[model samples]
Target: MPAGVRVTLRTDSSSLVCRYQADPAPTLNGPGERARIDVVCDGRRADTVKLETHGGDAGFRCEGLPGRMAAPGH
Candidate 1:
């Protein structure tokens, strides 16, 4: 299998909320193929989201809201 692509997202202390939407069109083949997605916030590791290349073409909704501080001095 070929190596997947990497996508980077950055956020700040003031701006903690974020949202993303995927295109509602299929552009690949196979049912077992996978698409890897990574989301980072405030220069720290935040969340890693993944989706399977199945169920036909469909749009996706991703959101990142403010949560508990990762560090104490936040």
Candidate 2:
């Protein structure tokens, strides 16, 4: 993911899934830095995903999310 990029998803399911391919050698601003994505659901901070590589393509599942529509907040 890039800076200032936001993706909104609307679904009635109680969980959210993600699959991504990493750039194994992504540029970083400092040594030992890692990319991260913040997950916000229903206007609250839910989780943070660290883009750690595990050989090749990887994925994650966020379960038990509220199954409703609501605006996100800062």
Candidate 3:
């Protein structure tokens, strides 16, 4: 995927989860790092996700609830 690329999905689900991997990341940390990933539903803030990264090379997950995404002008 290129930078600034937007993706959309159309569905009728009350909740959804997105998971992805970042190759060549950092190692797993002992205490880990604290971060928050926001979930947007219908162009609005729907939920906030708590993330703990053990290392640079790790998996990032994002989730949303009761949201729908489709290609623009669809």
Candidate 4:
């Protein structure tokens, strides 16, 4: 797992869904260490995904998000 990561998506839809996997207990560092993934959408933070190394398939839903994906040059 990386220290920090960022992902940006453009959409007009207020409702959004996210599916991800996290390794909260990453063995890459030592025996066991806590790890988590942060989710941010359109400058707005949606949630923080807690993971457990082998943890699989997590879902997140966000509604009423602000902003529309502008088409290049007004």
What order do you get sorting by lDDT, best first?
A: 2, 4, 3, 1
What TM-score should be assigned to candidate 2?
0.61
For residues 49-72, what per-residue lDDT tens digits would candidate 3 score against the true structure?
A: 654444443334454555445445
Best by lDDT: 2
Candidate 4, superposed: residue stretches over 4 Å from native: 1-3, 22-55, 70-74
Residue 10's lDDT in candidate 2: 77
TM-scores for all predictions: 0.34, 0.61, 0.46, 0.45
Task: Please give, for residues 1-74, the per-residue lDDT of candidate 2 as tens digits.
Answer: 36887888877678788877766644467677667777788767787877655666656667777777665452
* lDDT values for all models: 0.46, 0.70, 0.53, 0.57
Error of 4 at 19 (Å): 1.0
TM-score of 1: 0.34
lDDT of 1 by residue, 18-52 (tens): 33444553444777555544555545545655554
Q: Can you write out model 4's per-residue Cα lDDT over 1-74, one digit (the tens) per residue? A: 56656666667766667766643423356755455556556455656655534355555556655557645532
> Looking at candidate 2, what is the lDDT of residue 62?
77
Q: How far off is residue 49 in model 4, in Å?
A: 7.9
Ranking by TM-score: 2, 3, 4, 1
